[model samples]
Target: MEKFPGAEEWVPARGGLPKVAERLKDCRGCDLWEDAEQVVPGDGPAKARMMLVGEQPGDVEDKEGQVFVGPAGRLLDKALEAAGITRDSVYITNAVKHFRFERRGKRRIHKTPAVGHIVACGPWLAREREIVKPELVVVLGAVAARALLGTGFKVTEHRGEPVELPDGTAAVATVHPSSVVRSEEYRRDFGLFVDDLRAAGALLA
Candidate 1:
């Protein structure tokens, strides 16, 4: 099998999550390390059956070193509550561990991660999937769909649909929570986003 770009060096050849964390702390596999505050590794149970992956860390996540803790996260929390999924019940992470941004005066505007950035970060995400072995992967955007599914992934066509991988793990794609925040029809779009999350959670029932 072909190995992902930085997997062997970054993820443990032997250890578990802690080891992954250690390598991630000093990862220089990509230039994203030069600008971001730190690696925002996935957070939740060690063996969660459901994994929720997003695009990348936002400004808040970069500063705090936590996944989904900003405006987007707050919205996700609300939707998850409505969906009957507890925050602690699943793992949450980003497609890219580091924040890629363009600095404006006082703020760092989020820049969509280039393909190379995602390719470089693939190993860490693969390791996360390997370790967690989730029964369900909820990809929360086109970026995440591409990272977890493939380059050809289209959220518009496949969102909320359960796709079975060759390995037999199940994944569903959806709009990132941030999209709802950016949408002009926040209320309507937010409802649809919650519906998608509810469907993903339904598989567990």
Candidate 2:
């Protein structure tokens, strides 16, 4: 495990999303950038009411240079629609901007990012939160939960329950969309995921 100084220095003290996105490309805050194709920053309106945060970019997202455009993303879109939450109304990003993976033959299998990676990427997520100031943050898995809420936050225990942060921002945790995509009981799991989203949506309402 390597230690990084974190991304605070790379983040501009005064700028909006565009400036953050542009400067993110040049961040050497962690070694994850060494293998990643590019940094995939958060995407959505500057002042969305909600924000969705995941663990990190997948192979497709790393290649495409976009967030929430993979199979999991497609499922997320469907789930959001089912929850009566418009996709365009929320901002989406990952806790870590780079794609972490293990090469297996011709395939790049997704690897969960270590805590250091999340810590290294903290500044970027903080910047996005500051700029968006979303009414509620939807954390899509344990990694995301840890990034925003802190370590020891468990999605299984608190899924669909809105928790107030130290800053008074609300957040809800749920399994990653990929988990539902990979579930044996796909329909059931997806339905539950939508239910969680709907609960979060209700908080917004």
lDDT of each candidate versus the true structure? 0.86, 0.93
How far is 148's C-alpha from truth in model 1 (Å)?
Answer: 1.5
After aligning candidate 1 to the native by TM-score, how far in Å is the CA of 178 from where it should be? 0.3
Per-residue lDDT tens digits for candidate 1, residues 1-205, read 2233554466676677777777899787778888898888889987998999999999999999999999999999999999999999898888899999999998899999887788888888888888888899898998887777787878989888888755678888899999998999999999999989999998877
Best by lDDT: 2
lDDT score, candidate 1: 0.86
* Candidate 1 stretches greater than 4 Å from native: 1-7
Q: Candidate 2: give the clashing pairs.
A: none
- Please give the lDDT score at residue 146 for candidate 1: 75
Listed in order, each prediction's TM-score against the native is 0.94, 0.98
lDDT of 2 at 51: 94
Candidate 2 per-residue lDDT, tens place, 1-205, comes to 5689899889988889999999999999989999999999989999999999999999899999999899999999999999999999999999999999999998999999998999999999999999999999999999998888888777899999989766789988999999999999999999999999999999989
Clashing residue pairs in candidate 1 are none
